[model samples]
Target: MSLADLEPNSLHVVLHVRSHPPKANDFHWGLYLHRDFEAGGTKYHLKGADKRWLADHGTTRGVFKSFLLIGLCQVARIPSGLMKDVDAMFRTYDHQLNEMPGLTCRTWVFRVLELLQKPHSGQVLLECNDLTSLEYELLSWGNANALAAADCQQPRPTHRSDLCGL
Candidate 1:
């Protein structure tokens, strides 16, 4: 859907997952924030090849194309007013690869989720409560989809629903 379709003063937080490599169950994570029509949103994701996170202020379609998205772990509705705050939080969200344990796209996505789940001005940003459950859900989906595709020698999932069972 186009940005115009979203409700005023709100945006969508989509947690995306894709196969990492070498192993089917190994997965990477990313986020897509779709804001209202006026303030175009951005994508915060890690490029496995570069081993660093990249934020792209490009068209939603273009970002999705580059993501090679496999599944959506979760979709949340957040107030559009929090856009700048969230972006700033992302920019300053301490991500020291050397100090981190097994740093990957998943770690970055998890940190983002932790930030979003915090109460902002007494208002919770994301609808989710438990981050562990969210991770488990995504892991389950990845194991099923990734392993199936690898074993069956099937093409990558072509539809959004195919990946997440949404």
Candidate 2:
């Protein structure tokens, strides 16, 4: 599903590769943090052992953190629950980040709707098999409706003359 499906105030933290040029249109994976912890906090600390630990797990961790910085700058607001989900997602992927020695990470917030309008061109779509059947159905319906509306013509505005300048 497109990032636009996220709620209006949903917050997303993003990061991108510094070596790559930014794009106008793209979808990037974002980490949604809990609202209570949305503001800046104690800095994330990764050292030699931690880095080695992550590397031992896989490559995705480092990739995820690098991208978090970019998404965070684009987010405006985020729902509390979605934020929690993001934090949990990060923890789930922490192993990947721990492997990168001397790598840096940053964070920011923006309106979910706004970010979706200008997503990173290099972003990747993640498959969410965790969604319930009903949730999936609803998402499908919403996407279909949005597509149909985008293709439809707008109704013309009608003119009226009740009280002309006196």
Candidate lDDT scores, in order, read 0.53, 0.29
Please provide TM-scores, in order, for all candidate models, with all chains considered together: 0.64, 0.24
**Candidate 1 lDDT, tens digit per residue, 1-166?**
3444444433332433344442544665666666656754566665544445444333354432343344333345555577778767665544554355566667777777777778887776766677677677666666666654434342333222222222
The TM-score, computed over Cα atoms with residue i paired to residue i, of candidate 1 is 0.64
Evaluated against the true structure, the overall lDDT of model 2 is 0.29
What tens digits encode model 2's per-residue C-alpha lDDT throughout 34-57? 122233321122223324532111
The best candidate by lDDT is 1
Model 1 misplaced regions, further than 4 Å: 1-24, 37-40, 48-59, 94-98, 147-166
Name the 10 consecutive residues with the lowest summed lDDT in model 1: 157-166
